[model samples]
Target: MRLSNTLLALGLTAVEATQFWHNTGTKSGWDAYTHEHKGTVDEVTDQVYKGSTALRMTQIHDSSYSGRYHSEAVKFNAYKKGDTGFYGFAFRLQDNWQFSPAQGYNLAQFITDFSDLNCGEDYMPSTMVWIDGDQLATRVKYGEVCPTDQQKIKSFDGLKKVTAGVWHRVEIQASWKSDNTGFFKLWYDGEKVVEAYNLPTNVGDGRPFQFRVGLYANAWHDHGYEGTQGTRQVWYDQIAAGDAFADAAPDKW
Candidate 1:
């Protein structure tokens, strides 16, 4: 919803995003959605952050299977080169979530397709927010999107504590620059955890990137699933994004 000058001052308004918001009560808000084999996406009322419903994303481990696990909702054109914005959401891990210090569980990411190149990763992700065990981690990807592009990945880990079974907030503000002039920052549970600046924040490929959230058991596909908790679930609510921090702040808007 674009807030008019009056609304911007009065803190009221209309439309979609200059502002965008989703209660995760239904599938109607996302630009695209997916749930791979054995993974399920549902709207339930058992737990919520702000509204009556929340999205439940679940993935089950397959010891004998070799496919990736993902149940996600995508917001297309979330950002591109030179665009600056704020994105935020509320999430909760299942009560019995098992944390493996050696493995990672990705929660959100910004990505774009580079199939036109055909020499490197097809769908390259620019920035990703995740948890390695109970600690928060994030990173930036830059350089040309090609086979010999250096694949520069600058990672920032051990940012914050991620607790299970309770609702937590996440907010990211980024300047989408493919050169060493961009900045990226993250806030966890209302606390500023990561502050980065003057760094290349994306690939040389200037394609529009999609913002995706939910459960992506990427480690299972790359490092193999860990422990016995084969089936894992996560809940998300109060998803939002826009040009200003308050427009996307989970608690503000």
Candidate 2:
């Protein structure tokens, strides 16, 4: 669902502002959908968290293909430099997922294109959530979107224990601010794992960043599929963004 009038404004009391809700039951509702190499994003009915269907994101490691592995659904204009919003999604890993000696598997991110700066970086991401080993982690990227002294990223790891073959809820609420006046809070399965205030939630640029949720096997690109399982599967459902938690939460709305 693009930023449009038809987007869902969900809540006990709708905020009267533009919000988004996608059940992940279909492939045609998102602003954009993308995949790479042997990766695929499909709607599946066998495993679902909401409605009758959910999105299954799969990625196969191809040693011959040296590209980023991603199968994601994108929502544009999710936020900017000075906006505040809540984003939530429910995801489940494959029943046979390998956790020991685990590599990185990115689940969601807020990214924006910064090619206009030509700083050797293309689309730089601001906030990202992922699973590292058996723990869930997240990060915040700040500084100028271009070549600058302050361009840097800081990570927060060991948030919670991650399990496979089960539904897990993730909710992130942020007050986007370039200065040290913003706040970022993340909830994992209704447990508040990370909470920080007076921090830089994103870069100083004003470009509109998109919220994307899926299986992005970035470890394959950087660390070379360390796990024995070349084919990875993850299911996502009830992806949403809104002005408040109830509007974006899968169970609340």
lDDT tens readout by residue for model 1, 1-253:
2223442332222235567444444565566777998998888889988868888999988888898888988877677888888888889999999999888989999988878777857777889999999999999988877765578999999998888999999999988888989999989888988889999888877778888889999999999777878998999887877777776677775
Q: What is the lDDT of candidate 1?
A: 0.81
What lDDT does each candidate get?
Answer: 0.81, 0.83
Q: What C-alpha lDDT does candidate 2 achieve relative to the native structure?
A: 0.83
- Candidate 2 clashing pairs, residues 3+ apart or interchain: 1-30
Off by over 4 Å in 1: 1-17, 20-25
Write one digit per residue (lDDT tens) for candidate 2, span 1-253.
1344544332212333545554445566677777998889998899999788889999999889999998998877778888888889999999999985559999999987878888888888789999998799998888887675568777899999999999999999998888899889999999999999988988988888988899999998988778588999999988777777876777775
* Alpha-carbon TM-score of each model against the true structure: 0.91, 0.92
Model 2 residue-pair collision total:
1
Best by lDDT: 2
